[model samples]
Target: IEGPDLISKLRSEHGVSVPVLMLTERRELSDKIRAFRSGADDYVTKPFDIPELEVRLQAIVNRAQGRPATRRLTDGGLTLDLATLIASREGRQLRLYPGTRKLLQVLMRASPSAVSRQELEHALWGDDPPDRDLLRSHMSAL
Candidate 1:
């Protein structure tokens, strides 16, 4: 009937790896501790900021799923600088055009997961995409 009870039931019925974020009106320390001990991943009291709550939920899910918050992406000797939009391999900077950079960013972010051709096209150009198969050209450039 309560958050802790629900968490216990979920973990038992499902698995312990299930992520749980408890948002409740109970502000007491004892209540928070109890909820956590019963397997709640995060505790946010009422009157919390929406953005903060969203971030906390994302953090919990990331931890549960073993995915870190990605700023830069890297593989082998190649690296993609997310902030500066510079990509390099083995200390040598690789030239990337605007469209190619965008494609690389999207593809790297979705690494280890297959991305469909349609998704790549959507990322390159929203609804009004070019009528030609320009995605292949960008892929070649990247």
Candidate 2:
């Protein structure tokens, strides 16, 4: 059976308890999408880098074991618990609204990297995004 078929079988039998990473020779977008739709956690094509593959396997294991790759991100006096969506800075708890919390999560994950306004909006609301500079409002609250 093919990789996607195998993934579908595993998902049906185990119900997502097993993390499936597809390492295949097919590099087409349709093939990748089919694997994901069949319940693959990750996919890598042929001629892959060993280090990158190992990292992806570790990430899948972490997710399957109920341990996030980064449970809490700490930089100086700030901390954000990714699992619980709790955040604090300088020994003070922050009351983050839903939009603000999402924005913070995206920003924290892309720390030190410049995130475009368009990317932020897409992250918050894909395709049918809000009009105007509404992301600014979320940023202010954050």
lDDT scores in order: 0.80, 0.80
Q: Can you write out model 1's per-residue Cα lDDT over 8-54, one digit (the tens) per residue?
A: 87887877667889889999999999999989989999989754674
Provide the global lDDT of candidate 1 against the true structure: 0.80
How many residue pairs clash in all the candidates, one count each?
0, 0
Residue-level lDDT for 45 in candidate 2: 93
TM-score of each: 0.50, 0.55
- Candidate 2 residue runs with Cα over 4 Å from true position: 1-6, 9-68
Kindly list the per-residue Cα lDDT of model 2 for residues 13-56, writing each as its tens digit: 86755788888899899999999999989999989975467557
* Global Cα lDDT for candidate 2: 0.80
Worst 10 residues of 1 by lDDT: 50-59
